[model samples]
Target: MVWPIDLAVLTLVVMVAIGSLMVKDLLGAAILFGAYSFMMCLLWTVMGAVDVAFTEASVGAGVSTVFFVGAVFRTSRRTRD
Candidate 1:
């Protein structure tokens, strides 16, 4: 794997992780988490772990993101007194 590309993807992964945590909106955080998962899949692909990469892409980025967004939509934006 080329060091520069790997470093870039790794940097993106870290940035996305932090961004997801820092996001105030649940939907935005879920999108960031999906991006993070996609970056992780790319990192795994660069490392020659194709199976793991596929799993991350499918389960982490795909299914989990859908679930998170759905859950976020279902939740009411209300603060209980």
Candidate 2:
């Protein structure tokens, strides 16, 4: 690789990851998780791994997030503990 991933984008990814973990609402968590996946895709692209980026975009950012949101909508958002 000629260059490295930008620090700013990496920081944003970390923030989104933390936000996804910290959110109480399942829907909000799903959104943040999608954002995290997108950021990862971006980082992968920046690293010149187009195939990995595409796979992450389609699977992590697209299909998985949709599935998570759908499941979240079907279930109660509140925790049982």
Candidate 3:
């Protein structure tokens, strides 16, 4: 019952991770990573860990996304040859 749901969440996280790695654009990859964090946070909530979920949602989705975007801004959006 609960195990299945957990497994699905874990699968989603893994898929998002893979997508993030495979993405060529840095900004797009960062967005995917943020979405991954959001999914993981939801999974945590589903597992009855509200505090962990909150932290993950805030830090992972919010803070991490901001940092990644800042890094992207520091560098050019175009890829160099």
RMSD of each: 2.9, 2.2, 2.2
| Residue lDDT tens for model 2, 12-67 | 89999998988888888999999999999998888889999999999999999999
Order of candidate numbers by TM-score, starting with the best:
1, 2, 3
Candidates' C-alpha lDDT: 0.89, 0.88, 0.90
Give the alpha carbon lDDT tens digit for every residue of 24-52 in model 1: 77888889999999999999999889999
Off by over 4 Å in 1: 77-81
Candidate 3 per-residue lDDT over residues 1-81, each given as its tens digit? 288889988999999999988887889888999999999998999899999999999999999999998999899556431
**At residue 8, what lDDT does model 2 achieve?**
70
The list of candidate 3 runs beyond 4 A from truth reads: 78-81
Error (Å) of candidate 3 at residue 66 is: 1.0
TM-score of model 3 vs. true structure = 0.87
Backbone clashes for every candidate come to: 0, 0, 0
